[model samples]
Target: MIAPADHLTPDALERAQRHLVAKAIAEFAHERLISPERRDDGGWRLTVPLGDAEYLFDAVRAELDHWIVDEDSIRRLVRGTATDLDAQQLILELQPQLGLSDELLPLYLEEIASTLAGSMFKIAQGGPTADALADADADFQTVEAAMTEGHPGFVANNGRIGFGVSDHAAFAPEAGRPFRLVWTAARRSSSHLALGAGIDEEQLLSGELSAAERDRFATRLRDLGEDPADFHLLPVHPWQWENRVAITFAPDLARRDLVLIGESEDEYRAQQSVRTMFNTSHPHRHYVKTALAVQNMGFLRGLSPAYMRVTPAINDWVAELAAGDDTLRDAGFRVLRERASIGYTGDVYHRTAEPSAHRKMLAALWRESPVPLVSGSQRLATLASLLHRDGEGRSVVGALVRASGIPAAEWVRSALRAYLRPVVHCLLAHDLAFMPHGENLILILDEHVPTGVFMKDIGEEVALLSARTLPEDVRRIVSPVDDEEKALAIFTDVFDGVLRHLAGILHVDGVLPEIEFWRLVAETVDEHAAEHPHLDSLVDLRADSFAHSCLNRLQLRNTLRMVDLADQSSSLMYAGRLENPIGRARIPQPAARETVGG
Candidate 1:
């Protein structure tokens, strides 16, 4: 067994704190949460209201108001004396500026500490360098495990508050250890299972479990005085089963409404999204996503049972639409649909007035895995790996460009065609938009060049703003977004949320300049527009600027549930207008913009 405290070394903790502090400074500055004044030495200085506390760092003001701060150059000062670059302490120093309420300050601090600990764990593990991860021969899971950065935008991205050190070691995605899922049989009357088109319960079960394992679970149900035919089998995360279900639903277990079966025969590894698991033993099997009652990022990471009921239908609708569209099909884009889902209703939790963690504890969904989709020359990697940098500051994307033996500009263009082209087509042609962040995509690479992408987490993240007719069951995805803010699905979610970080990484790593990067993006959009002249005028890609929807601001206001998933538009927190890079790139330059940091 790995020691729980093995990774919590002093050196690792300090390094983690430094990197996190730099990220906090950069993101907070981008959101206009804090202003750092320019210094004579071409650096920036931020003096907080807290007694004699200030931060000094060298930074470049990139497009979209992104502050590309040098982590190594950061120095924390008090009374003109240097101190350790403590991330938690920096939060306290900037508490007044951050607009953290008295009630929310400590809770946010706990989350920061949790994020720091996760960073330390990753530092201690020290698996693969960015160069190795960039290789086409590297396994999909290896690249997933090597990723240290969670969400590039969110400072406290890894706040798994419910996890102890032991739980972190056993269940966190960074651990990358294979473990069997805890299986359970819930009485048919108290549970619901939804399957996608043409798939039956038997087919789902047979695919997930071997015949002997199925017989073992059925016999266990019989021994418990329950008929196997009268129950539905559910796979659960071991952490959730032990930490949440065992105690919270003890009554249901005693009443024989739910019975513990055996564990899964096939071992599974946790994906970047902690609740989701990939079948390592049987790579072709479906990915199982379980309800994890942990407070991570902005919400309690739980799958809703009510939402589960319509998941398959929503996925089915999206898949059929994608398959029939020639543009999307030609772009090599695919949606990894959630094929089946099962949720158990406990009697005690249903009595609550609102949807809480208790009510969301027992649901799980099986999404089609992207493993079998790749062939001989093709490999799978998380899109997040594109922004990854090793301890020595060598980037995975830079390594991939070198390995491909292609110019950085051409590689970026290929990436745009594979990733961004489909996204733009989906929005204009189909009136569909996905929350296509790094973690949500499986980037398909052929000999270190991006060929296509597999989009997952479909049921929760997809949005349909179209007025087109749809079946009643699939209407849940229809979001009534305002016309002006509609483009923000790409502008805010894609540009500021993802590409801004990638641009910074590429610029900093010396692979590509920020100006040329945005030029290629603008060129890609222009080319796509020329091809599809009958596109919807929902939002213009050539607009001067768009609303700056701030992620950290939402988290700062409500550390619990930042935004309701059902109506994401209503809860948006915006900073000011961000200058559109694409719009600027379209104009002929009188003078070339100088590269700042790189």
Candidate 2:
């Protein structure tokens, strides 16, 4: 990088001239090879592989003429002082080559004006003698002219350099003592020995000081505000006092204000003992005992009577089975057997076995069935109840039987056949017996039946099956049949019985009147079909038939009101019943009036 100003030698000037010439040649060559063509017909065309074409030749000739004229002007300016030349001519020739445009011209002019203004202001504020001021102003103008001519080489020879001007008077007194100058060998070798100590405003105005001395003089003039620049100046060096600097103490100083409280270790222990005694006397002790029971057993399944009775017993049996010693496992086996017998006998003895008893029995068998003889008997009894119920009961039974260590696939097959095939066949028979292609009954069956018995731990088992799709080493156990089939079978059984069995039971059970029940089924099927229009065919088979079945079930139960149940043909009978109500009211009124008169 070039210094801001250094005396330019003849050789350096010649080198700059040579560089400009070479740049001109390169520009000329580019224009010749890449210039666009203009046709006489007012169209533009680019000739392929432009190798000394006629258009390129004309472009080169034009560029050469401009370059030659500029070169002659530069030569004339270099021979004498470049100050007289038009600044615009030099800018036009050099700015475009330097990648500067007309938009940037104002910024360049502002910078030059600011530079000269700052130098004049600094000299005036420094209180320079008149002669010194004249010389500084003259030097500033000379340097400005050379810069405009693009002869940066000449500007250096004119002794103009940029440097910081410091004001000594502006230094803060409380901050330190004044700094003393020390002449070092390096400063002396650089021919920079003189240093200005104080200002003489009149002397700075005279052209007596050399450029170097004028800079030092300007520094002093700036302090007196006689030749101030556009910006402020700071002292060349500043002294700092240790006492003036702020020191921060440790964080613990703030922490000291916080008062420490609470019990010491010994007191804490004493308080804990008191708390223990109080807690024992509180009603919470019952809750604590119950929580311990649950922890020892397991979490509650549900709060219904069926779940409440079975969950604790099941948990206790599970804990026994999980015990490490044979004694505990045997104890667990005994408990399981007892629970299973009690559950099975409950159905026969009390004849009011909770629906979940079969489920509990199955859960017990699953917990205790590691020993074959004991587990097998439990499995058979549970299976018998489940199958006789047409596998309509709780899922826990099938899960328990499958989970048992019965060592017999036939038993598993029998359980599956009993639960799945019978339900599926019944659904198929009912659906086909009415509407042969109907699949709606299948959907109803799945809703009511236990998913686990049919799908077999569906949440866990399905995921296990999906893993089997991978390579052998990575394969996981899964069901032999696809989940869709399992799901379909489960659903079909439930739906088949929806209109036939479930609606009938609901009527017999008297939970909902038959007409209301049919209305609900109709509304549900219609809304479902409307939402899923694609299932219309399947829905159509069941919609009407199922509604009819619900009506028939309502009739059989005699729960539907005569007005609500009667067909058009039976309307007269229902009308007669309405009249009977009015007649009955009249008979009661006459009796009441006769009693009042007497």
Highest TM-score scorer: 1
- Candidate 1, residues 105-176, lDDT tens digits: the string is 899999999999999999988878888999878999999988899999999999999999998988888899
CA lDDT of each prediction against the hidden true structure: 0.90, 0.23
TM-score of each: 0.97, 0.14
Model 2 is weakest, by summed lDDT over 10 consecutive residues, at 288-297
- Clash totals for all candidate models: 0, 35
Task: Please give the lDDT score for candidate 2.
Answer: 0.23
RMSD of 1: 4.4
| Candidate 2 per-residue C-alpha lDDT over 402-450 given as tens digits, one digit per residue, 9 for 90 to 100 | 3443422333333333233333322222211111111111110111121
